[model samples]
Target: MTYTRFAIYDAPSDDALAEFGATWLGWDIRTGCATDQPDVHGLDDITMTPRKYGFHGTLKPPFRLATGTDVGGLQVAVTEMAATCAPTKSGGLALTTLGGFLALIPTGDLSGLERVAGACVRALDPFRAPQSKADLIRRRKAGLSARQETLMLRWGYPYVMEEFRFHLTLSARMPDQDRAQWFQTAQANLPPLNEIYAIDSIALCGERADGRFELIQRYALTG
Candidate 1:
């Protein structure tokens, strides 16, 4: 079985996004239970792609372990890294369409978010297995830009550091009409994020035998 780790954040259980993910994805990573979907047209098919990923924005993209490194060692390193990093506060999140998909995006400066994510990519890199030829060829089919190719070759995933935009995906790409409707419904379903949310914790997640990712542990940003 292949194992991959991801650094992810969350929305409080009572939060709108929390419920949105539960209903849309059929499972809540936090509760680890199946959930009911909202009664909306094309909801099931539209969410099929991200449903497999559950919810939460990607920090460190998934990758297998490198030789000489194991989950035990990776856990220790992640814990230490979280302790040294400080949590960040953003202007809050807005539900909007990003590249034909629906997601929650930060409304203000994201320098702090960038720092934390970049650190995760760098500090835990030794644990990541290099991208294989198959992976590269598959990714290239998406038609990467020159910079994206560079980042992919270096980090195993293209979107990182300077290229990263923090977004918690709500749905996969859809037709314009579907995207518009979902955006409106999502804005209504998601809880109001008028206050500050501290990006203070990082959850360590791993893919299970079933191909679904599960939250293994969460480390607080102590610094």
Candidate 2:
């Protein structure tokens, strides 16, 4: 099971994108419910891990709050952060293979996206609980480099800073052949996100006891 984390996630801005994503992943973040998903051999297995988190790009990789911290205070901080950060414009979107898996990737203006993610990771870190020894050991098992180990110790997660890659995960690991098949299916069936899109909002999400993450709140970026 994935670690329980309080993450900043970029949720879909519209219902069409939301429904398409939920149907593809089989879990709706807005409703906290499972919905009808695509039917295909091994579709469930392919999407198992991502389905638990719903459709989101990790802005701040998950972390629990420090002792004596409260969720209410966290939500207030997120709202304040969004208020000062202007919305970002993604040049467009694409569907492609990312490390043996499928995800939605931004085409250009990535520097803007990077700023948003970095801000969240830095500004909200005061609330984050330190990584436990068990978690640190688990990350090392994934073969982190010296730089990655350094980032892990500093940020409580291995993939951050220069290592961060913004992706809205579509599936777990797949064979080369299976990846191609699903990519074709997704490109043909999912809603087209090719035109310019705005990163107008951010979502605060919390992991549940059952390992699924639930939407706590969504704050619009107003600046």
Worst ten in a row by lDDT for model 2: 1-10
Model 2 TM-score relative to the real fold: 0.94
Name the regions of candidate 1 deviating beyond 4 angstroms. 1-16
**Local accuracy by lDDT, each model:** 0.78, 0.86
Off by over 4 Å in 2: 1-4
Model 2, span 1-223: residue lDDT tens: 2336688999886777778889899898777789888777777888899998998889998889898888878988999899988888877778889999999888877888888988898889988999889999989998999999999999888788888889889999888878788998888768766488678899999888877887888999887
Q: What is the TM-score of each candidate against the true structure?
A: 0.92, 0.94
* Residue 12 in candidate 1, Cα distance off native in Å: 5.6
Cα shift from native, residue 213, model 2 (Å)? 1.1
lDDT of 1: 0.78
